[model samples]
Target chain A: MNEKIRHLREQMKRLNLEGMIVSNPISIRYLTNIQAEGTLLITRKENIFITYAMYMEDVNSTLTINDEVIVVDIKNISKDEFENFFLFCENVGFEEGYVTYAEYKKIYQRYKVNNLVETEGIVEKQRIIKDNIEIENIKKACEITDNCFSHLLTFIKKDMTEKQVANEIERYFKENEADGLAFETVVAFGENSSKPHWIPSDRKINSGEPILIDMGCKYNGYCSDMTRTIFLGCILEEYKPYYDAVLKNEILSLDQIKDGVVVKKATEIIDENLKRNNINLIHALGHGVGMEIHEAPIIHTNVESYFKENMVIAIEPAVYFPSNYGIRIEDTVVVTKNGCIPLTKSDKNYIVI
Target chain B: MNEKIRHLREQMKRLNLEGMIVSNPISIRYLTNIQAEGTLLITRKENIFITYAMYMEDVNSTLTINDEVIVVDIKNISKDEFENFFLFCENVGFEEGYVTYAEYKKIYQRYKVNNLVETEGIVEKQRIIKDNIEIENIKKACEITDNCFSHLLTFIKKDMTEKQVANEIERYFKENEADGLAFETVVAFGENSSKPHWIPSDRKINSGEPILIDMGCKYNGYCSDMTRTIFLGCILEEYKPYYDAVLKNEILSLDQIKDGVVVKKATEIIDENLKRNNINLIHALGHGVGMEIHEAPIIHTNVESYFKENMVIAIEPAVYFPSNYGIRIEDTVVVTKNGCIPLTKSDKNYIVI
Candidate 1:
């Protein structure tokens, strides 16, 4: 059996689950390395993948016996055959966080399980600790993102629209051979930067205005996330404090990230430091990133999790002045024993392009 | 009140639902023009949108009082305020297809409703009939897609990897001012075209082989999907029958599309025609395309739906020969009273690049 599936089987046993239906694409990729449309059924005896006939050729060519997974076309298998796979299993696990209620009911009827148990995000918990290959892919994705940012610095002009710059960032990622964007590229100009989740619009760029960009890309199925806010021509004197506060807290929180440190402590430091300057850290401090852009172990005031070694995450600190401007500094990092290593090598110093 | 919401109110009355909680982002965009991260609640007296503080500014600037929707920051309001919106309601409806089981439990507790009922895809049913503005946006998206297809024929070469061509397709859309892709662009080379939903790989395009490209993009939130299969050099004589079957059925289906026709009949026609040549119409004939690339009134053999006037859909007819080659011809169209007008103007004829 593949090591990841074997480890998952152990976790399932601990939860008193005889079998599991893994539906999340990320989890399926983590276990079998098959990135296609399908459902993975980990029966008591074997791992079976049910997919449409159209994908059978691709899945067969990509996976093998060493992966310890059998691929079956859904058309060739009867509903009775699917049910028979779990006839002896008393309890089956399902991804409660991802499956719809309607799908949940369908799984129940199709498998005819006695009890369907929630895995309680067991797969997500397993995904937090990145393996070597995962780390390498994430680091490469970050490298491409940093290169894109550097390219943007040279590409942005005063007359260009915010949407144009955003489009160029996406264009850069694809041309440079990174899989499409990790998320929609956020390119906000001037007062539009006040909203942390602003989408790029057709507002033309102007001198002495702020430009905030949050962008990332996926490489080999791993994701990278980074954000940088820069000025077009000059920085406003009145916005100095807000800008400095965001930068200082973003650096402070980065230094404090390490194994065994509570995730909220980083958020607390940002909140307390920003509060002293009459500002607020309104959003999450960070979140885990992997196959999915946003994964487990969210860094926030309400979350009670601690950082672990080899865990990949992004930390973003910001202060927004509604309808005026906002400053944010973000970086993707890999947690270490003493501290975290920043994967995004983009310079964080204030820049006026 | 907006007409769509008022129309939904009538559906709600028939379903015995005094209140409805809509969490699907597409559904939220369908009712309100605002497309940010939020949840929409339809109560007896008013419509409420609850979003994070980060999105409050954007939402406020986009939505107006005439839209009859009140925007509230989730932080300033307690769980009690959310419950109060639906306080007097006897029964509440929820989207069964979109909401997960875990989210269903959270909504159940948050609202404290007496009865939580399934809306039975009521919003999706309404979305099938395109409004004038929606049709215009979809037409524009299709126009952009057709232009991209024209560009691809001249840009594609024998040495380019599948991923490279796919990336160029996405770049073209963004550069042309389309709002990203409707779905991931599928670019297959040689035998890779046998898989209907093949992800672009590093396989280099070879001469005298098939290349299949399925791509789409959104314009103003409406989507357009199109597919075309062509030869890198010359078409293989053995693959000629498979190609002709797909193209013939595609055109035949387009001619039969009109108001009040059963959707399954189209699928049956494709299936019967292909079976005579020992080919299969392995997938759905097509699906409705609007705010979503794949929406209501799925054109499949099992679906019992009738064509509606002004409904935008894509008819994709395909034939796959395992480990060999495949051909598919698809076009997005608007159903009219007499027939259907092609929204996607890409040529369906075989091309030798």
Candidate 2:
């Protein structure tokens, strides 16, 4: 049996749960090496995997499972899959706020589940504290990202359309052996940069305006996220003040990041700096980065969570002047006991393109 | 003023729906120029959208919607965005099976939604029959796919990993200005071709095996789905019967297809021929191809629907022989009153790679 399955059993025991159902794909991947696409139900006595036709092959080919872990395909099974599941579990701890009425109806009609508690953060809380294997993969993903950036920079000159630059980045991503782009590559230029999460358009890059390139790459299944902002032509003296504030704030927030640091507190620091500059940082200060580009330990104003060792995150704070200009600097990092180490090796110097 | 939104409004009025909540992004995009990264609620009275930060900017910039279409930032709106959505909607006809319990709580709680109806084929029923603009883009996407195939064939001669071939297709997709590969380009050679959805492995291609290349391109937001199986070097004479049967079935099905033709009925003919060869088809006969590759009007056994006029679909019937080889011939076609018009003009011939 995998250690994760045993660890989860302990969690179930502590919560007074007879069983727990794991449906979220990421959580399933985390618990079992079963790359099989499906849900895994962990009971006090037995652990079961519900799958379609495809995931069966994946489990057989890749995963190492204990004999006790049962595998059932919904196709070959009866409607009793849900009924049988509930019958087995008495005091069940489910994912908090993750189930639907439709799902509830099927289960409710099937079994008399008395103890259904919403235990949302248990697995995610564990995930935020990464093992050594996760850190190595994430670091490798970052290295791939950096290499892609280095190759892409040589091609991103003045007058390149946002789409063209995006194309180049994607091209380099594959050539450099990335699984794929972690997310849609954002290559906003000039005034367009004002819109955070702007899709790469065909707008031409012009002198005197800043260009923002936010991109990431997926290595294996783990993802790396990075964003860099640079201005074209001469670096404007007036822009530097706002840019410096953003940079100093990003570095300062990252500096505060360490194991046991509260996420809300980190946001307060960024908020205080942004307040000093009379800017509203509408987004969260930072967010955990891992298999999914955005994951657990969301560092914001209200999240009741703290950082932990081996947890990777992207600390990005931006000052946007809507329809005018915007500046943001971001990096991938891991929380250490003392502080954090930058996973992204891309240079963050303010420069002219 | 877009026609799709107008059409949806008519649907809402007929359903006595005060409003319709669209959770599928592609469906939202089909109706409104606005693609919902999160969800879009459309009432007979008004339209609203809730999406993440990234796509909201793009849609807001491009779409011209009525003032009342409230676009909410889902990340900021609720405790958990998916659960929050259920809370936001009232008396809504959800895209029933599409939404999970994780997504229904908030809107479901907020609304007196006893009138919750399962909208079986709302967007898909509409999307199955595309308009002029959609057809033009799908045609263009197919052309791009065809050209990439022709170009790659000119250069590929052996001694390349499956990854390299996949990369080459991606490069050609970019070089010819495709949005991106519609899905990860599948390049399987020899025995790897046996698995229908084989992810490109690092294995080198060997001679004397049937090669399968299933690829597509997304031009604009519309996509093209296609699959082409080719024989490398010379093949045994016995294999020709299977190849002929596959091609004959595709041609016969294309001839028999017309508006109002039962989808599975089309597959029944192929299934009968497949039985003659003692082969069981693993997947559905075909699927409606549109903005999304696998849309609606699934052509398979137990499908209780029929193809309608203007409905575009990819009719692919494959025969899989484990550990040896397989043959699949696919093409995109438009359902019409008389019979069918083949949209993807790429001829499936015995290409000796």
Candidate 3:
């Protein structure tokens, strides 16, 4: 957290601003170890965590921070609070992209404030590269994730619904060793597999339909994301080609994920790979996988961001048939000088089991 | 949703509000069935939903609303757009609790508006009572939760870490027929259970210690919450008194949960019971549970809200021994005219498997 605070302070120096208003809860949590749904007002001079709820006890018990962290309660928020805080800054920078017009009024009118600038994505930009601890946690999370999936394969039967499979995965995560799931387990079977963000349903896994499972686990606050699609029964010889295409594309993207490469180029390779197989690829090529599943340096074949060394990202090569089925192969990876290391260790080969 | 809207309209009438501005995402989702992170401006003359993101597409796919849900892009928000929509509203009400000061400024300044009044708990009031469908979903969610816990009991072992057990419960929910767990799976072992909201850790379960597991499942869109603390090994005679105190408190609360009893009174009963036993309870008795794990009509001894029939509330009787050990038993229940229907069926038995 101290390191994060230092990073923000350096950002303030670069922007020639005295302070920044961090409203995004995720960013606040990452920076302060406080996970409450609240806003953070940070400046070069001081930092105040504001909340309407009484979080004092929670802060004292759970949130360990340096003396630099100050807790503030919203009680008739006075203009003096903003001015006193902002006086240290030449300009007040806000995460403008996340805040709304209504939010602006409360701060400006109530505080009689002025000189606010939009400085979005700076924290996220820094978050793209994982620290050693963060990477280790991610790896541990992935290890738990892989073990859970392996157990699921053994526990799963044909009679179970997609929801059941999802639940089993969740239970396995807890039983194996995971703080919790990084996100909602996506267990889509047959037609449901077509929806990229399909919520698990009660529909049972049938004999001939394709099943796609996208899941992640959080270990020590870091997260790992992985996705694998398989068929309940014997895979048709024709579908194997598409499966092979996705696997090859994922491996190809992993091989290409070295330092100093444009993110677009990697996505383009996967895109061309899918196109070669005449599959309609949907969604982005991949995304950064860390404390947050989808972070920065997005691999979309057109993003301006470039892959840098030590940046952990997911490479998901998918082919969707809206009314029929969808197949996606995703693996979390850390960008290296030469290539990348896959975080999740699931055998992506078309499993007959 | 119509009933909810009508209920809120009646609240508006009572509060002398002609319209309301709901910026809280949960409130908006509850009112319109539009699961979009945006604002919903409700007036007698006009209703509008505004957002900067392409939530319209998401809403269209996710929700089936009766009224014509308006879509407002952030780029097009002007004074005319804000004022014209609320032209007929003599007193426009706003969710002051949720609308941040900064957002308030952006709206007030951009719209050149000054007529909106702070409307407190208008939508929250309607969300208290459980409808038939909501109750139905809650029941299914609870059933799934119960089944998951039962499966968990079958596989209980001494050496498994808290993380692994937590993972198993989550997986069970997804596989059995659930959207996901309602909240983080709390699998606190032994002394770790001392923290009421303990994050699952990599601690091994030891014999003779209380294994406290608080977990829930989300089915459909509704949620179920339940908690059970059990002796992992042999029962300690010294701990039986503490265990019995918590158990008796829950049973008494359940017996008293009839139509028209003040919810706070029920909470006070437990507090008094614990006090009589020389125990100082630190947290609230329970809370209203539904679409959200914690909702309106909090079961806190200090609160003034009364219990009503058909309200789904969580009854949690917990005894926290700070820094040493703790035990809590919680179950989601629906208050009935005669008594209450227990939604969660996870056995809160004192004995271990």
TM-score of each candidate? 0.91, 0.89, 0.75
- The DockQ leader among the candidates is 1
Question: What lDDT does candidate 2 reach at residue B146?
Answer: 88
Q: What is residue B315's positional error in candidate 2, in angstroms?
A: 0.8
Q: What DockQ number belongs to candidate 3?
A: 0.15
Q: What lDDT tens digits, residue by residue, belong to model 3 across residues A183-296?
A: 988999888887888888778887877889999988877888999997876786767888888889889989987898887877787687789899767678888887787778
TM-score for model 3?
Answer: 0.75
lDDT of 2 by residue, A188-209 (tens): 8878888778888879998887
DockQ of 2: 0.35
Q: Quote model 1's TM-score.
A: 0.91
DockQ of predictions, in order shown: 0.71, 0.35, 0.15
* Each model's lDDT: 0.89, 0.78, 0.79
Q: Number of backbone collisions per candidate, in order?
A: 0, 9, 57
Model 2 lDDT per residue over B1-353, tens place:
56887777677667766566677777877777665466777654556677777666666876665434566676676455444344444456877556666566555664445566667667777787889889899989989998888887776677778888888888788768788778877888888888888899888877777778899989988888888888667766766888888888888888878877777677787788888876688988788888888878788877867778888889887888887778888888888898778777776867886
Residue-level lDDT of model 3, residues B81-118, one tens digit each, is 66676665678787766775556656566544447677
